[model samples]
Target: MDHLLPLSRVAKLVGTSRHALQEMIRSGTLDTFDGMVELNELLRAFPDTKWEDDAEFRRITEIKERAFGKRVFERALPDKEVLAARLFELGNEYAATKALLMHYSQVLSWLDEKIDEIEEDQNKETRHALHVLRAFIVRHLAEIPPDAAKVQALIAQERILKIMSAHVTIKPSGHEFIVESNDTLLEAALRAGVSLDYGCSNGNCGDCRARLISGEVRKVRAHDYVLSQAEKDSGVILLCSCAAVNDVVIEANVAGASDIHQQQLVVKVKAVEVFNPQVAALHLLAPRSQRLRYLAGQSVRLSAHGASGRYAIASCPCEERHIEIQVLRNADDAFSQLLFSGLNANENIELEGPYGEFVLEDASTRPIIFVAFGVGFAPVKSLIQHAMSLDLAESIDLHWLADEAGYYQNNLCRAWADALDNFTYITHASTTEVETTLANIVNDYPDLHRFDVYAAGTAAQLQLAKRVFLKHGLPAQQWRAGATDA
Candidate 1:
């Protein structure tokens, strides 16, 4: 018998503990045969062990080395190469004859099985047998050099068909939409009602840029928009020009509320209340059949008698058929004067859109900070009401800033703070004090990294607040700003 000793015997012979020998095997430093250690592997693992000095161990090691080399050579050679070498060496013997007989026996056995199957099938047709025979001949014949290209072309066609039939999945949102082989991603998304932000159906703008999280997509048309090298390397694709080639997962900005088409409606003015001499609240009712479906914090364009202005919706989204807008009277502006003075109850006005992306992100569980300046509070009020309706558990802090004359909604703010346990309202009397207030707020929460900060104000105020918040550890993604239209 070959000297393949058990691990315990090997450990004893090598003057090492059984645990040490086992550790070597466990860590792959030593190899074993079955459950026993091979003599050559034991020697290789501990070349300087005292057992090597013994005469018996030296003889056993020499025998193991010779057998190991023989086994390696037998395994390294291919079967065909070994058989061919054996035939050349044993031509005078019956080795080649035996191999030829074995091949013929296998062929006969396969044919016999096929014949039995055919004979047993009572409903077998002659055409079926002919078809099988034709297929077998054609398959073998296609392997010939003259027909090989045609066979390969058929395989490539099948693979292409498979790739053209793949579906796409948008990640994080888990929206699955089908992209036909010839259609661009944007077309498919629009067709499936999966709204992705886009501008110009053509590829001139990069608004439809989305990251390819996994799988494959191919550009189906030319794009004029130049993407940065980093964007390209990060797997960003232009949705208007790319078609999915396989099961793909993409990261895209999909707004559910903005997915609906905008409508041009004639809404009736329900009522108008002058909250104060400088500020007024206007209520408009859309036609019941064409009620507006909009997100909170979105603005609408209202035109009355050729004078039009964009105003944020002050009412919560729960009031779908009716909307309330807060208007700050501009003494110099004729449009503001018409909205505040000329507009009357029961009068019809043109209302378009529910535009703007200032909606709340319900996915976030972080605390929220809302900064509203002057009539910017209109949208903030809507957002706060919507958040409250959703029963969101996050803490909400509202900082309302207005000039002394425009701060007419302090009572409303007070009512909200008193009603909601998680809500806090802080009013700043002057725009000049906004910077100091923001600075102090940031100082109080040194790590605003996890807070969703929203600022709605004049362009200058928003810009200043953006700089301060960004400098104070607010991530760009977590901070959103809506500039009140000039």
Candidate 2:
């Protein structure tokens, strides 16, 4: 049997982003069968992949880690039970393959005997042809392929990965993620920036229940929401509690913005990070059970010390339990003033929303251009980090047009640009000629029609940027903008 791997696993094995592999597939440089690549195909595509261990693989992962400044799930051994189940599955595969090989060997032996009997009774020409065929088989079987060691090392690494992590595929929506170590399906999915539907993540609500289409899942966490015998018999499992033992396919809903209801929570301030005199970041941690469920590029209403303001979240949703909002120190805004001076760690703050539609088109694979004007960088930053987490774009270009603040998070942007070849950071010093800057920026994208532009600014600034982008080749509907202020 030809060993096959999914595109996601092939990406991990090759130390390339899924988007890069996708590009290869689209260009016909790599071929896949039913969304899977044969083992030979994978070997052919990545002939230089170092399969001994993770040191070389860590190169790509390290860059992604730097680009996304969040503590991703730990890559460790799986739970003993899940590990045992995976081993059992692998053992079964091994046994079946061995059995087939033995059967093939017996068939070859019988064929040899039959050929000998025929050769003994045949003419000289027929017997000579038979002898030549036998010699050909013996010669090829005796010689090992040149890359046999490489193939063995690669398979060994893949088996270890299989024993440690399991890949998951969500149907209908077609989102994919890996279930690493002890993570439940829902935990892994959320960590991967896949916003599936769920409420009360600890599982009192049945909102997270989905039908398991295939593979084995063990319940890791207890839940109050009990399924009926019928549902249980039909393979219904709580995504929040069940851990996949091996590769799996499931039917689940991928939630959209309107699909997600506004959430309310009282969170504790984690820290107040002031970046110069003009800006500070308010980092808040939600209650473990009631963590905020919001998409990137959306605004949340935050209140502390009798002052409240709506600010775009400056952090990715993948950064679990932690919510970050950048505040511009405005004399007129009490919340901004509090963030700049009064907010301390562990202070209680009210949070509500995730309001606005200025979100990344998660499904779009087009190269993306993000334009942030002044404090407008708040939402754009969130969108950028989220895009990084999801690997949603083929390439990303960030145009941060500074006002008086002047690219306060310049170092962070530089770090991302340095770590990712596909990411470009262009900082515009506080420019009086904003339109000229916008025009110059748009001029760089001669093929704007094939791209998606996400711009965040005040209403006037967004209008100006949108006009410039559309005046170039950008499609009108492809332009998404968020108004940051009056």
Candidate 3:
């Protein structure tokens, strides 16, 4: 004869909420017998529920069959309510079973909202009692069956091994990468050539910072970077020090098209025009069949003979065959001297890359604020021209800071401001004036967080500007910075 249990008893037996079981009954998804549900019917309705000791139960039945009992234990499955009552009776002596009973009681109290109604002192007492009971159970369980416990522990270890070998999926791009148990997320990403932003992979810098969107990860090693309390609470982890404990999804600033594999080519210099005594614009032309593919605001390594330098591509990507770079001559630098004096038209130069992540984010529709210092304007010019070509509707404000001699292309910038309805230009000649200008800009647009800020300058200048912008309520995610090559 099948024994029937109440809905609440079924909920307790299955470790599910009573409300869920009630919904099944109300929706006609489950049939009740005399205000109760049969254990078989509940299992049929919730097929995914895990029943403890199922394998042991089957083994016991087989043993009985092999022993002179013809399927004696076949119909021995007890009613959930009766089983639960009998387990509580046994729990008075078995510490492990007692701990399970306490856990279920606390869960039921929480579900009934009774925990919230309890006094803080009573709650603390209950929690402390539960903790002590759990410890006692753990200590006692170790003495029950050493060999069986060892086998169960090995089974748990195998389950954990499977979880640790799971793959990680990067969001927005849906890129999948496997994470070894011993490897950090950044190490796995680098091995797979995933092109994530990173610097000083030892975690001294926060460049490899990413948010854990879903799943679990743990810090596998200590990190030098100091994260704020809010960052920790928000699930931000340094990829260089974090390893996935299970399949995980992370949100990070992934590399786009410009970050793909770089190509090496030898190109001919078409022209080298000296804008002033200190600055020159060098134009180069790649072979018609092998034009360079790159995004605006990316820099390339240019080498001729023994001199090599990293210079930003000042021209827009639309001019594929023609590459323009602005070089600031330095008295002590070999590459600068070579470009200023030793370079000539039609000279062969080796070009290596189109690197850097300073390009404009097309996904943003917010207004833009660009601040450039000295030769840092090179990439800014390329970005602005590209934005103009795209006919982006957002307003653009450009702040150029340099000595009088460095603003050789001031007229061109003014021309852009005059031609484009959405563009605005401002120039500052002194460091103090630049600081004042940036402060005034922030004051003028009290909501600085609504704009995307791009800054290019010396490392010191970029750092100072980032601090100021962040203080003025601009989010770190809304700002990009590029350090000018010395």
Tens-digit lDDT track of model 1 for 88-189: 444533576688879977886687567666666545586477557757855764577653454344334323333333456677775555454356787666
Q: Estimate candidate 2's alpha-carbon lDDT, on a 0 to 1 scale.
A: 0.87
Ranking by lDDT: 2, 3, 1
TM-score, candidate 1, is 0.48
Off by over 4 Å in 1: 1-257, 431-433
Model 3 off-target regions past 4 Å? Answer: 1-259, 432-434
* Model 2 per-residue lDDT tens digits across residues 139-200: 98889999898899989888988998999999998888888878889888877778888887
RMSD vs true structure, all candidates: 27.2, 1.8, 24.1
Candidate of highest TM-score: 2
- Over 352-434, each residue of candidate 3 has an lDDT whose tens digit, in order, gives 98788888775565789888888889899888765653333268899887854568888778767765556899887765555
RMSD in Å for candidate 3, one decimal? 24.1
For all predicted structures, in order, the TM-scores are: 0.48, 0.95, 0.47
What ranking emerges by TM-score with the best candidate at the front?
2, 1, 3
Decide which is better by lDDT, 2 or 3. Answer: 2
Those runs of model 2 whose alpha carbons end farther than 4 Å from true positions after fitting are: 52-54
